[model samples]
Target: MTLSFDGTVIVPAADPDDGERTAEALVPHLTPTSSVIIVNVIEKAGGAPDKASMEQREKHAEDIFERTRRPLQSTDAALETDILYGTDIVERIFAEAQDRTADAVVFAPREGNRLAELLTGDVARRLVKEASVPVVALPQRDV
Candidate 1:
């Protein structure tokens, strides 16, 4: 089957490299007219949080977006960035996807220890199970 994405694509930007890697991997599938929305969610901790830490998190997220956008410069794909704060990461992503009227959701499979997966819950697995739009996970690879 020939696969392609044209409308807004919701990309999970969990790390600096995740977005870059995902864009590169999708180069073959995406057309020059495609637009990608790179999103990073900072899971909020319960209870009141300090202002300084929150500011720091936002700054760091901007840095990640800058780094991620660098590699995608070679592609004709239009890029957009979003930094979100929420308790449920997956839900936040889904909400953004729906609000943006995304044609698909793309993510780079994050490798974690079994214990980590059990503790935090696997995002990739959960997305596959519940995503309303098509979910595309690029094959795992070393950075």
Candidate 2:
């Protein structure tokens, strides 16, 4: 069945490192008939940032898209992009996944996880916990 897959990538540092390769490794998704939405979450100042700052952040995300777009574009499936502001990305990722009617959500491993998971504050753990649709989380396993 055709479905939308949510591939949300977030990097804590200033660099625009993508969570794509890891996210893809976790989930065998994105068929040619399936639609994929590539999302990047930027933490807004929460209130107001100077227009310049906002523009810079958007540009940063755009830069990430440009850098990250190759793999998605090279894939057989059609892909789209989105930029969103969220104080808490884990929450936003799940919300967006549901809002977009994604049949499944794929994410790269983060350092946050329940103390029990032996993983530690990782988005991957949260996605597995909260995602309504099936969530695929690839750990940092060297292949």
Residue-by-residue lDDT tens digits, candidate 1, 22-131: 76676666678889888888888757663448777788788778877876677788988999878888888999999898998897777678899888788878898888
* Number of the top-ranking candidate, with lDDT as the measure: 1
Which residue pairs show collisions in model 1? none
Error of 2 at 84 (Å): 0.8
Clashing pairs in 2: 111-120, 111-122, 112-120, 112-121, 112-122, 113-120, 113-121, 113-122
RMSD in order of candidates: 2.4, 5.6
For candidate 2, the 10 contiguous residues with the lowest summed lDDT are 6-15
In order, what lDDT does every prediction score?
Answer: 0.80, 0.58
